[model samples]
Target: MTPNDPIDKGDLLNVIKWAIIGIVAIAIVLAAMAGFGQLNVNNVITLLTILAIALPIYYFVMMLRSSKVTKVERSRVKAYIPLFFAAAIFWGIEESGSVVLALFAEQRTVLHIGSWHFAAANFQSLNPLFIMILTPVFVWLWEHWKKQPSAPGKFSAGLVFAGLSYMWMALPGMLFGTSGRVSPFWLVGSWFIVEIAEMLISPIGLSITTKLAPNAFRSQMMSMWFMADATGQAINAQIVKFYSTDTEVQYFLAIGLVSVVFGIIMFILVKKINTLMEGIH
Candidate 1:
């Protein structure tokens, strides 16, 4: 904002006001979805309710407190949005695919690792478990690299890995026809690929905001980082509405193709995007 364009107190208040309105609107839509049998889980509603309350409160405060943007900084901030958005979309689809994976997982069986066995009910933690084990090794590998992808390139690579994760699942869904449970190893394999993608994306995500964000809009850009993920998950919610046992195979194939296609495009265009970023990597 220019010096002449003073921050109106009412305008600032209005931002918070509209934030509440948007949250309430989403809450209503979620409530309606739950009412209509689209979503019926207490845990999901509780998470949404907490997000409805907490996210706006955090951002409203940030909006009030953040400094004004300069024209150059504004341009930089604009450049990062698409990059963050691309990474966020990867997160959305890959993570959302987990829910679909579970829809096909064996409910009555157990999964084995080494000497240990786990019931299907505990399979949800597999991703995090993979993440915890792999992170240090990945971090070490990253540290040893002489040349690295630009921030945009790293994000693109993550997208490709994410797409590959779904493609792996698509193979089984295609072969198994969703009529009976596939081996738990399919779930294990899919989770393994995603956790690898997360390792690539998550570290880059944590760093790029600081590297790329405008001084005036640092916090706001970070907020955008989060919003990108939220937007992707919102898309996932809609996608989930169409998924079922019968459609599982095709669902994985379609999304996998979309992600991989976009990822290839992103990989091809990474240098151009990085050039547009003006050395933010």
Candidate 2:
């Protein structure tokens, strides 16, 4: 067919129909499992989280296959798939500064220094505060540095740092024990580390999303970046249930290890991912 000819819609329609059927089937099975007592609240949420991550990806792949997308475009988008998940995992930890970290600040941290006292809610400001402080420094660094890591490399490093933030929280419980209130610096430090990860992942991820987007689905691709954050928070809703005074150390260690391990795995795959990116550095 000529380049001017309209692409066929049949494949796209079929993909939509199949995707809906598949999602419905998975949801029904999960619900049935819950009804039969095979799934607890956490189990249900975990599976639903997988579904949340997978569904959009399923549609994205189908759309690419059905459309008039080029090989180069397809490869770049494929490269973006792994990065998307990495961003989601990073966001899961980063966004939790408000929910999980805030809970820690309120319930576990000692909120005073010397004669100074502050609200636990005030701790939330540390995120934006650190971002503001670090942004210019990082901008200058990226500009002056002749060699920088690829987006995937930055993301991998970001995940490690994100994981370390959680791991750092585990230390307060470990060193001082999990019962009494610890110093507020622990919370501040965790926020500081995760915000560093945010600097590595957030802006870089946004830039790479624009660079990698297919011309036909430019807007949708950007939406997918936001969707990554949403997906992370959705998963957090389930995992955060496991956190409490007694489970504090275990919770932090578990989530932190997961992020760190995934970061290492991503690092190992960097060369492969770079190849998939096809020169969009």
Best by TM-score: 2
Q: What C-alpha RMSD separates each model from the true structure?
A: 6.1, 4.1
Clashing pairs in 1: none
lDDT of 1 by residue, 1-281 (tens): 45334448997899899989988988987798778888767547556645644664465445444566555555555557557667666877766745766665654123666688766657788887998999899888878987977777777777777888888877765775656555677778888887887887777786887776666556666776777677567667667767777777677778877777777888898877776667667
Tens-digit lDDT track for model 2 on 81-176?
889999999999998988889889999999899999999999989988999999999999899988899999999999999999999999999999
What overall lDDT goes with each candidate model? Answer: 0.70, 0.89
The regions of model 1 sitting more than 4 angstroms off are 1-11, 14-67, 107-117
Worst 10 residues of 2 by lDDT: 1-10
Clashes of 2: 0
Clashing pairs in 2: none
lDDT of 1: 0.70
- Prediction 2 TM-score vs. true: 0.84
The best candidate by lDDT is: 2
TM-score of each: 0.76, 0.84
Native-to-model Cα distance after best TM-score fit, residue 202 in candidate 1, in Å? 1.5
Error of 2 at 119 (Å): 0.7
